[model samples]
Target: MTAAGYITDVDYIPGFYPQLAPVAMRHVAALNGVVPPRIADGFRYLELGCGLGRSLTTLAAANPQGTFVGVDVNPEHTAATQRDITAGGLANTRVITSDFASLPADLGEFEFITLHGVWSWVAPEVREQILAAAQRHLAPGGLLLVSYNSMPGWAHLQPIRGIIRQYAVLRQGDSAQRVREALAYLLFIRERHAKYFEDNPRAAAYVDGIVKQDVRYIAHEYLNEHWTSFYFAEVAGMFSRAGLSFVGSLPVHTNFWDLCVRPEFQELFRTTTDRLITEAHKDFCANTAFRWDLYARAPRAMKSFEERVREADDIEFRVTRAGVTLPHQTNLDVVTSTVQGPLYQALLDMMSTGSRPLSAIVADPRVAGTPPADVSRAVDAGVALGLFEISARHVDTATGEPRGPYAMPNDFNRAVIASDALSGRAVAVASQLTGTGHTLGDLDAGILNELVERGEDGLAPRVGARLTAAGRSLERDGKPIKDQTEQGVIMAQACEAFCRTSLRQFLQLGIVSPG
Candidate 1:
């Protein structure tokens, strides 16, 4: 085993987390009444243990103004990330292969630092090194995002982890093979009506969920000897040692009191402005199993309401898709409520047409007279509830034309399109418009490649050829279409949808362009 007690032989998956985007981090901070790194001047970003660099490379490509760096102990991870950086021709991002304690001294400070799966899966010593890195390098007012498995929810499942890990050690081969054996043994036990599974149905169901996950993921998740899930208060206490204060959690709604817990349990939070207490209480109510939490090295609360409004102006929001009606009622996990009203209707109306700055949406004549703060809250609520989305303005608000220099479907995007078309990995291509990755399914990727090769022509030929070569069959309604005419009709329908929906959106996001 590695000295750090991490899973090193099997590499982690390539995944992009939208919350790690610089624009998203800035918005979450501002939404919670904190001043973030100024957007106009740009900022530096770092991801400790950045597995495969999907999030890192995509964000760097999406945000030209921001410089990005990724550090991971795994050389394979760094090598793959660097391959994308070079092939995608991203000059704004770099990756370093080094464990946390031995990070290069020349590496400068970062305005944003994030660690997604690292916190709960490393040795205590490695965690100390992580904190040491943050204490030494996090710039003033910089945000640090740490996502990990949390307690209460994982409490019942702790025995489940132990059983798998124990089973793994008794078997042979590498982490992956061992995990497969362990998973099989556990499933065998559950199927035999073991007392533990019989007593805890949720845990039994959780085992079922585990078996369906990727073997690579299961290996890395459970095989690590240092796996530890933490309670919120305990985690906060540790970050405090590194001079970081927990500000708010992600999905935006977590920061709001009314949106955090059940309506009946809401009384439990009314007496506390202390986030530590509220977070613990909120966790118990919702039994939140995992969290994407934001913390700042130097917590800087906005000094005035005007400053908060100014922050909102730079952040933009829009309906997630065209014709999205505001839900008459909203549910934020355990918290459910009736949010329909004049302001909500006005919000839906204004954003339905295009992405607009929070200031602009709240200032519209329809939503006017509503307090800007209240309006901003509503916008955040919609985002949390999946009613709206956050984006970068790709057009001149006044001129109704493209604004920023459009360079998407670049060398990097081409490689992604080619890979995703065949792999069906659901990985995203970089987007300048959203300042994040835009993901498409296998068929959409095929359609995009066709558009890249030859636009507005017959579809089923090239796309279907790619599928057949990849050993995949073209299917409709879960049944393979062997007949050419039927396949042509289905492909035609898919072509219409790609153009009407995803293609149009991709054009706005600059993920693809006219060759």
Candidate 2:
């Protein structure tokens, strides 16, 4: 509850999210007349409100051939992002600290521009500037990703925001304390005014999850000065004004679910286009707050098959040079078992073409039924297994080196190995943090050692053993170091919290030490 307890990036949870970008890119690629600038490598990506650039780093790591630029007004955030970029040796990623309004006149063009966690939190003028920037900088047929708090789901939070805003403004110097107070007040009101949530487990569950988030996130998300939520119609109009059209979302499942859940919903909304259906659905759902939108500049052409193939070929070259593969697993049988399923068979079918970008495969007519998100997940799995490799063309060579935009992985020959490597490392890292008293450094060491012992690939572990060794050294010292706890219980809790909280994706991979 203390102001000193606050962390910078932790508070502003609004920032670039890379996981959804691949799906957005795929949708843009499929649009009419908007082929990516370079069919083979050297694609550009721009992120607005990049925060500390965590997502940008991940994207840079995943797609080595691509170039990334993150723009933000927060000097502290940009500095931190630069630190990470330099430390990770991700030469392909760059950060710029500047207000959106003053973005360079010729910021060049980007195939993918992301405004994740930005639109709803900025002032109207700032939002307009961002749109203008995107309009000017996005390539023909480029992708624009925007996420916001949509209606229906946002209704319940509206009251909470109203209450918190007044309180947070009064306690500007201590946002965390203000958040706790606001939460306590909400809990008190819920005791008497509870209605829809009490009857709906899903709603209750969602609220509970939010409450459990880091207090700083609660403060920034709920109590910000310019915080606002919008309807799909409103956001769609904004995108149109920016010269972008709504495509689809990575959470593509939910968009389709509306039809299945209501049966007639799709038929009734069939006449309407994507934005209208999305708006109607939001109204039906009572204004769901969180969503990711896939938008692309209109008046552009879809990427050609030859161009897609060329991009895939470049991605393959980068991956091979990096020598990244999946993790090695003790229970190879279990993983092998999973691979025999329809999903695995489908993946194998794609990999049979040797190394190819997952995006390209998903776009192919044979895989037309497959969703872009699914392809991303599959590719991520492949990367973990050491079956695939990732490298930035510029990272290996100088900035002038020619490289394509797409990221490719190894074919079936390395698929299992890559999968095992990636899964094992992810699980090992997750396990060490979730249940063991190990640091990220420890997890990194363990995974890297495993990878090396199994077979030395060129993928060097970025995280060093220093953090883990330092933790032990600090424990030996015992005296207070910053705000870290001295008590054994506190230390364990802190380590676990740090691990579980920051590395949430590891949990999704079924990694995590014994609970």
Candidate 3:
């Protein structure tokens, strides 16, 4: 380990990231004209700095055949994850407390190696060790995902972080308490309208976001001694030295050049044949603060439009759990536009039943007359617009009041559902069929937890009781619903919606099973 140990004073929060899933990574790779590791024969997975192993264990439950390992320097994080692994019966995963420099040689190679919160927060020497580990353990043709706080986006926020860290040093208390003090200091400065905050409304607004984050997250984020942001070209150069080349990016949408930049920036992408230049330009246009980049040790490049389409045939897509209507519109950070018309409608109609491979989608008669490239473009835009996903099952977009039939949720999901309300966090539940975690609302999880414990009888009231115990305000029109009758009515309504929509969807995703 580096002389400066990670902030052991506060344990890092566990997380479940769907983008790191093998199925999702493969989908992103295939979209960007690179062949991804095949998922059919099972694969080995590793996570560096897997805080609390939430994602690692959840994924182990989701993909039972895959071997999983997580390494973290903090014993608290590893020990917590071990509890979940045992609780969830996730025997496929193993957690070790070790830094990147001296990882066990016998740990062997992995088809997928990922590090999310580690890269930008560690020292230069540590980053070099990370690359060394990746080069040593990433199998040829395997993919490695590295997510870091990116440049340009973090550029303005750097000063805020620096001040917070400096102020934190003088403050007295544990890490979380110091974080609270530092944030109080930052907010006090911002409230006075510091010249920096006054000049940058975005940075000012960012402080409010920090205020809302979990204190633990704030501590790890702002208190890290080596926290640094990198430009795309520089990070790419570092990865190149490891014999790995860039495959693609995450959120899936970022891979689509046109979707990544606004209209005026379209010409820049069309003019640039080199992908590295294109990525750098996109970040500038979108002001990307963070990025999830995929690198492949032996990437098989797909150069032509036809070749990419042919390779993409094996890739599958589905209507996102949020569902889709053709004229889908969203106001996202990068760009926004309304998506509609025959191709999308055809795609939606085809995926209504379940996920379908691109080959089946294009060959379907509903979209037969459309060109293959057009179908690919629509899928890309749909994914970017938040209307689609690379998934294996379909659930109606969230609607209705939740009600239910109950067999217990999977052990992994039950662990999440059982604890989420109390944890003040709603980590997504694992879905075996999708090889991903399905997002669950807090109220819905509470209701599900109630149903599991007490059955549907008086379920709504029990869920309300849990909510009340959690100090939740049962409100109406932004005011607390003061009448007992009105509160009961509101809980009943929410319960109905969850049962009809979210509960049914959970059934399909295998978050819950049929008794």
TM-score of every model versus the real structure:
0.94, 0.61, 0.93
Candidate 2 vs candidate 3: the lDDT winner is 3
Model 3 is weakest, by summed lDDT over 10 consecutive residues, at 392-401
- The residue-level lDDT of candidate 3 at 224 comes to 86
Model 2: per-residue Cα lDDT over 1-515, one tens digit each:
11121234343542334334443345334322234334234578899878867667656644556788998777777887787677556778889888887777668998888877778877777778878898899887777778888776777657667766676566645678878877776666555557754664464555567677778678767765677888777888887888787765544333343322344445555566555675556456434567677777753443554544444323331132222223322122112212234553455455543445545557766556766656555554444333433321221211122222211121210222222232212311211111111123333333333332332232222112223333432233535444333443443444345343432323222222112
What does the lDDT read for residue 371 in candidate 1? 81
Q: Mind giving the per-residue lDDT tens digits that candidate 3 earns over 1-515?
A: 54254688888886788878888787777777787776666789999989988888888888888999999888888899889988888878999988888799898989899998889888888899999998999998889999999988899889989988999989999989999899998999899999999998888998888888999998888888899999988899999998999988988778887677899888977777787889999899998999999999988887765776565454567787545565778766767778778777888888776777776777789988888767876876777777877763333333344444567657888876777753556667888767877777677778878877778899778877777788875766657777877889989998888877777777667677656
**After TM-score superposition, what is the CA distance of residue 132 in candidate 1 from its true location, in Å?**
0.6
Model 1 lDDT-worst window of ten: 396-405
- Model 2 misplaced stretches (Cα beyond 4 Å): 1-16, 20-24, 27-39, 191-206, 254-261, 269-275, 282-287, 299-515
Give the Å shift of residue 468 in candidate 2: 9.0
Model 1: per-residue lDDT, tens digit, 74-188? 9999999999898788899999999999989989899999999889989999999999999988998999999989988899999899999999989989999999999989999
RMSD of each: 2.9, 12.0, 2.7
Off by over 4 Å in 1: 1-3, 326-331, 394-408, 475-489
The parts of candidate 3 lying over 4 Å away from their true place are 1-5, 303-315, 321-323, 392-404, 469-483
Backbone Cα, N, C clashes tallied per candidate:
0, 51, 11
Model 2 TM = 0.61
